[model samples]
Target: MPTILPALAAGALFGLGLIVSGMANPAKVLAFLDIAGEWDPSLAFVMGGAIPVAALGFALAKRRAAPLCAPAFSPPTKQGLDARLLGGAALFGIGWGLAGFCPGPALASFAFAGWKALLFVAAMLLGMAAFGRLSRPAPGPAPR
Candidate 1:
């Protein structure tokens, strides 16, 4: 019933699912994105299978007072569409298409994909660090 136990179990299950669903394989993802080439629709099926489970989880979480292992739920605060949101989405899509990773599956793939996976993960972490620095508020008193 420890917090870390559930997290580790969930992460392992997710990695297994990614491997089984072929999401951990860059070739599979690249093929899915290559519409003009040897296109693959299997990734679509993988996503189709995940959406319902994710939606159900969200529905359940919304009804819960607090998570079983957490103090409270902290969902996204930004709801309005903005240039930052759009740009981030575009970056994510581009990264996914180019590297066959969107984080979860990337980390899951590390075991088999080796150094390529490490490079992608390194780049991802670097980008996240850069974004944190760049988006930080200026250290100054509030304007009157």
Candidate 2:
């Protein structure tokens, strides 16, 4: 219950920030990506603003033994990049370029962005499920 409330609060705050920063809007994101035609540098400001805050958060987190909301800091175990990582990143970029919404903003847009956001979210979820199933190791024979 305690963990849920804080997580909810954090998510709400993040969604609010996305909305305020125009990240939840596909048109705005597309415009930002449109370097050849009508590029909007406003989102750059948002990224710039976020980088320092994220850096400070990381620095603070490094000083702490455990996170305030969890038992311990659980960072990514994977260090070096591989084909899976590169392929995943490429797919993510392609999806973002085509749909103008990555997972975070897509989820935020899902509330008020109507049918398009709904479709995107649905497709994203399906893709995630498919990946999970395909990536799972095959079952082996039980030990005697």
Candidate 3:
């Protein structure tokens, strides 16, 4: 309950940023990805702007033992890349190139992108569910 407000605020801000930065528009993203053709470099500025802010956030986080809204900071436990990581990243890049809609922007576009966003989000959710099911360990015999 205590963390709800912060979480909501962060999500709202992220969604607003996506919309304001033109990330919610598939055409804009597709244009940015089209480097050989009519490329749009505006999103580069957006990414450039985000890099510093994210860096600062990580710097600040490093000074604290625990996050403000949580008892501890849960960072990624993985050390190095493997086949699964590489495969996932390749799939993500391919999806971004083909659809011009990653998860964040896809969700942000949902309000105004209409049926297209709906279809994308639906497919994304289905993919996530399928992955969750497939990635789970197989059940074994009960421990004595």
Candidate 4:
């Protein structure tokens, strides 16, 4: 699809951002999260830089003009904080704290060939697959 190009470009930029911001390193991320122990506040600056650009992009996208590929924007409509959402957030936070690697940073860090990142990515994909299986609809009774 035509949108794939833009998506790839965005992903490349995101990977580049992770690289440039030193987010691709688990030790850097761990240090950032360690407020009481040798903390690094650089991630705040990274978010500060990204937030304005994202805000401007959102503002522009909110205009009536057609989206780049699709006829219109299709943002998620969910607003409620359901159990699954909360549980997922908790799991994500635990994983982040334990592994010091989220999906974005883990993928980007592969360039450095870290075994921990490889394991983290593999486990993350397996968890996603497990969730997909658990979320699937149950089979109905056969017609008599």
Q: What is candidate 2's TM-score against the reference?
A: 0.92
Clashes of each: 0, 0, 0, 0
Residue 115 in candidate 4, Cα distance off native in Å: 2.8
Every candidate's lDDT: 0.90, 0.90, 0.92, 0.88
The collision pairs in model 4 are none
**Model 4 residue 95 distance off true place after TM-score fit, in angstroms:** 0.4
The candidate that achieves the highest TM-score relative to the unseen native structure: 3
Clashing pairs in 3: none
lDDT (0-100) at residue 121 of candidate 1? 95
lDDT winner, 2 or 4: 2
TM-scores vs. true structure, each candidate: 0.88, 0.92, 0.93, 0.89
Cα displacement (angstroms), candidate 4, residue 63, comes to 1.4
* Tens digits of lDDT, candidate 1, 49-92: 99999999999898889998789998888888999999999989
Q: Which sections of candidate 1 miss by over 4 Å?
A: 138-144
Alpha-carbon runs more than 4 Å astray in model 4: 139-144
Better of 1 and 4 by lDDT: 1
Off by over 4 Å in 2: 139-144
Ranking by TM-score: 3, 2, 4, 1
| Ten-residue stretch with the least lDDT total in model 4 | 135-144
Q: How many backbone clashes does candidate 2 have?
A: 0
lDDT of 2: 0.90
